[model samples]
Target chain A: MSNAIDRGKIEALKSMLLSLHKGESIEELKRKFKDVLETISPVEIPLVEQELVREGVSISEILRLCDLHVELIRDTLRSSLLMDVPKGHPVSLISRENEHIAKLAEALNVYAGALSKASSGEAESHLKAISNILAELRKSRLHYRKIQMLIFPYLERRGITAIPRVLWGREDQVIVKLRELSTLVEKELTHPKEYPNIAEKAMEVSREISDLIFREERILLPAVWILLSEGEWVAIHEAAKDIGYLIPIDVEWASRAKLLLPYEVNGVVTREQVESLPQEFKFAALATLAPDTYEVRSEEDLEFETGFLSKDEVEAIFRHLPIEVTYADVNDRVTFFSQSIFRKGFARTKTIIGRRLGYCHPPRLEHFVKSNVDDLKAGKS
Target chain B: MSNAIDRGKIEALKSMLLSLHKGESIEELKRKFKDVLETISPVEIPLVEQELVREGVSISEILRLCDLHVELIRDTLRSSLLMDVPKGHPVSLISRENEHIAKLAEALNVYAGALSKASSGEAESHLKAISNILAELRKSRLHYRKIQMLIFPYLERRGITAIPRVLWGREDQVIVKLRELSTLVEKELTHPKEYPNIAEKAMEVSREISDLIFREERILLPAVWILLSEGEWVAIHEAAKDIGYLIPIDVEWASRAKLLLPYEVNGVVTREQVESLPQEFKFAALATLAPDTYEVRSEEDLEFETGFLSKDEVEAIFRHLPIEVTYADVNDRVTFFSQSIFRKGFARTKTIIGRRLGYCHPPRLEHFVKSNVDDLKAGKS
Candidate 1:
């Protein structure tokens, strides 16, 4: 791989990548890659790849030069894998795990801030706070470890591995830093004289954790652009459906990638290989695989059919809605409410569930409550 | 008078005044006016001498058994006169000639969470929009007439008579109401068409001006309150100072009588006598009678005093401050900036004033600018 050859290969690859548009089929991507590779020496491939991975390419530059459809890129890559990808997909599982880790990082930051502000004499109080925050952070770490140990092996087997390895390393650094800060905080709790100094160290640890978050957002996941295929992402998404993200909401993908295989490979595929394909692929294959094995629809079709949510999944989905929800019965009694940590005031189901609407009012203003409710129900005041 | 007679006279005066607080001066006031009265009846004395001549008071049936302090009662009467009588006093002058006649009622309800959402419209566009707002409402007629004919007379007598009564009347109302609706806007020219329909009735003559403002704030002000006070509020403060209020800031009363005398006069002192007394004799003779003789305090005793600013008043005062000022300047290049109506993005005397240092960046590299500023400034970076 001479420098001249590598530079030419990089330029051709960049041009091809820039020309790629949204919704291009697998054949289009393969053709573009093949054309660029044919003109380049094989030895230059590694250098070209590394150059593409380097940072400092401004987002504006990408927006201006990239031929890939912005919306498609965002839809496939930025969307949460767990929510958008099909069941049993590898990408979905990774996304859900990443989300859990992010939540843990946030919780740790809160705890670290609180502990730093705590007095040395209040050791027990600081410990309790740190324990709670660390507990949440630990949950994220456990989720991350699951993906690194259990999930990455399958991706590595398929040659879609480098991105996860990088992210996992970054995650380990965060865990080590957090552990060190936690120990320092614990020691300071027992020694009143070491109050302010321990706080400064805790803040430094919190900052490092924040930097880890930045790495995940800017470097780690973005590197996945060169890895996960659409079908794998769909499969991982489906497999991770049961796993929960820290702050759940509908996740959006960043970009979509299509995979292509040669005709010779298709002829060698077995029944098991076909069965293991993603749901979308399975449906598409069944539609055309054998005309006698599937029914055909003749009427003009306007509606699209999709997967159904299980009862528990439906409940979980509502629980993870972005906006807070509280409902009162027709009788004006509190029936249910979502318990969000960021809630402005205390709300306990036990205290409010069957309580009369008037009970919520301050003692001096019970009449005002009854009157407002009556006014709402009645046609006239 | 004998001690017993003096005590009896005090008690009698208290009874006459419906047993209100009988301060130390009650007997003296009673004795001074005792011989001049046409009637000696306890009820008649209060109605004639105290109630009619000074601030009026009516005895409630519920107060029959209460003991009264004469000095407290007199002080109350004095303060009431101070408030209502001072048509030309600083407080009265500023309050009475309030140019934004329509917003006056709402301004008074500041304590009740009203009139706090004041804001100006956009730079070039908002000025025209606000002008259209004022012209469309045609509220200036009634608002201006009321202040000029009804209110300015009283304010003018107090040496506060400088602000162009008509012009300021128009500007003040526009500035205040514009400020109230400024933040609630989705666009510079078009305000929300709902209550406080600032966009629709730019200058409609309606008594419900305050009501409209209150309604507009219910939606617009809260969102503005978040950033407006902390960052952008400085700009509004600077602009407000330059425009100046409709009434003068420092007022000199026409006469002490305006502050200490009630509207209705008692027949105790003949009108001829009051008229015949020299102006100096009226004030000076109350305690000492020599012309041009006055008690003077030494310059050493005249030290500067400081006081706290109420949250709303602070906003008002800051808006009116002479020099432009910005916050966190050494860190960011103009994160917040103040552009006065007179100045075009530059402060005349205080350039780079009230601008968050960060805002000075060229359009293309804002992020780079921010990162460099943040890093170079250490934690502030």
Candidate 2:
């Protein structure tokens, strides 16, 4: 009923979280703030959380507590947030797709339940279920592509980078793990021992992924709805068209459609438009959610301390290097790989760019690589 | 001293190493193979280690046993690997630099001995000692750069890539840790709590540096001597000339240098020849240790199903991409980074190649990246 955010309620939540981090017993934490803990609505969670961060609570600390916060609020979380979905809106479609993805993950996990042991029915059917799950999991890549291209850039432009930094990294980890599990199933099909591990990994991944979808819908979508402008959502929907989503939308945001129509004039609908347009148009109004877009211009040649080169020349120089180069960022996300002319040192594709470092080698060698990296970091080597 | 390649002797060593890995009690191992283990030479350790790898032992498996093998052979490992160093030999110069590095390390560790407690010295002197060590530790970069450029390419060409893979990755790691320690000391000067940790890290790093030098002189040099050819060593020395070693060589490999000179008709010494030659040439014959070098032919441009791309075009394509990329191979040694025209993402140089992935971030974030990578690989995320 109240429009104003309660600063005292937020402080209670913050102190509870800080106390929890200080190794305070959860029982004590609950006892200390029993009234506030029970009364805090899920709708206020992100608002208070964001405000805490703005007031200098560490993003990493918030990340450490995020899921725990969600868990604590799970019961009261459902009834609080009011959905004001506009039919055919980009946010509306994304919310629907989140539900679909959760269903898909649940369906796979149910099928995977048949695969706890190699002795469960026909090995052939069990493996078939796994193969089918792998196929559907592969479609999650489309979900990821949408998030990376559409949502992340929008979040970043809104200075909501912490979520993308922490959350999208988790997404990349999920994809890499999915790929790993798929490879295990595909390559080691004859080994029955691989089945149990596959089922376990698949179930875990599916559950984690479904949880991610919930976070997006509950925390992220509402924030985007409030923060973004109309034209930005239009750009996002347009980009999503270029890189499709997990599920197709059956509706479009109608109030923005008039603004979207390039040839429409004076708020008047022509007779031809009435006949040619889709038979039924949903009446949905939006205050428009627009995200900022960056413009890239290649104005001139790149000059280095040692020499100068055109963009073409710089590209040529990298390509001409005797060895192939692939770069994984500090976050282990593959950002680029040079296509070597001398010899294609390591084969890489565009899709691999946003993935983590785990897939670049045979799975067995991954540990050794990882250990060496750790030792290098810890000065143990 | 048998000059013969005794098959039984090699097998015995391999089996001992394998048994050690199999978690055979070290006491039992000592009882079973006490005679052989104590007598194994430093040169024989790598020889047996390399042979074990060739005989179906995984290189990674050997890596696990590497330290244990070093420990087992520590007693008489010193006496058996005889150095036939000529005064001006490249090996001799490297050996001298190893001594310098070891002493440098020992000196720092000794200085670091003061700071175990906060009361070890004036905070000013403690900081100054750390600063000096950091400056010297930074020079390990030169030791690394030379090895990457001069030795690794030659090793890979010789099909001796396993050594480069393991050893060079370790070197890259050392350089990265060195860089990390330097940053911590530089940034955390005002924090007294940071100094004891710095002291501990510096001591660890210095001791490791000294141990690395010992490995180089005792194991690697001897291995290089046996495996490489005269021209390969000359090429290594030549490449070393380009890259520079940790410390400059006051001597030259002259028999090779005379051969390095273009055809001179007269065998007799002339006054003009003596005057014209570079004054710094000191006679050092390397017992003529050389490595096998591969002749690389530029057969043609790389062809893929997508289309053929010239080295230039491939470079252009990578440079044209929006993201900067660097490739660290399965060993975590950085092989390459693409220079994107849009943003110089990670400031990488030629020196970074043959270095580990640890160099990509701060010491704190290195663990974060490594853990993420391992989690991705393990399918844990």
- Which number leads on lDDT? 2
Q: Write one digit per residue (lDDT tens) for candidate 1, span B1-381.
A: 111223344444445454224433445554554553213322222222222112222223212212122122223212231233334333333233322432332222221111112334223343343444444334333333333322332222221223323334443565455445444433444543342344333323222443333222222122122211121222222222233345444543333222110101111322343343334223322332221111111232211111111223222322433333333333232212222233323222111222233333222445787787677558452
Q: What is the TM-score of each predicted model, taking all chains together? A: 0.21, 0.31
Can you write out model 1's per-residue Cα lDDT over A189-216, one digit (the tens) per residue? Answer: 5654564565556545545554554444
Cα error, candidate 2, residue A233 (Å): 39
- Tens digits of per-residue lDDT for model 2, A124-240: 575676676677767776666666546555444432344555666667777777788778777656665557777688777876776677667556665556544566567566656
* CAPRI accuracy category, model 2: incorrect
TM-score of the second chain for every model: 0.19, 0.50
Q: Score candidate 1 by DockQ.
A: 0.01
Candidate 1 matches the true fold with a TM-score of: 0.21
Candidate 2, residue B359: the lDDT equals 36
Interface CA RMSD, all predictions: 30.6, 18.9
Note the clash tally of each candidate. 67, 26
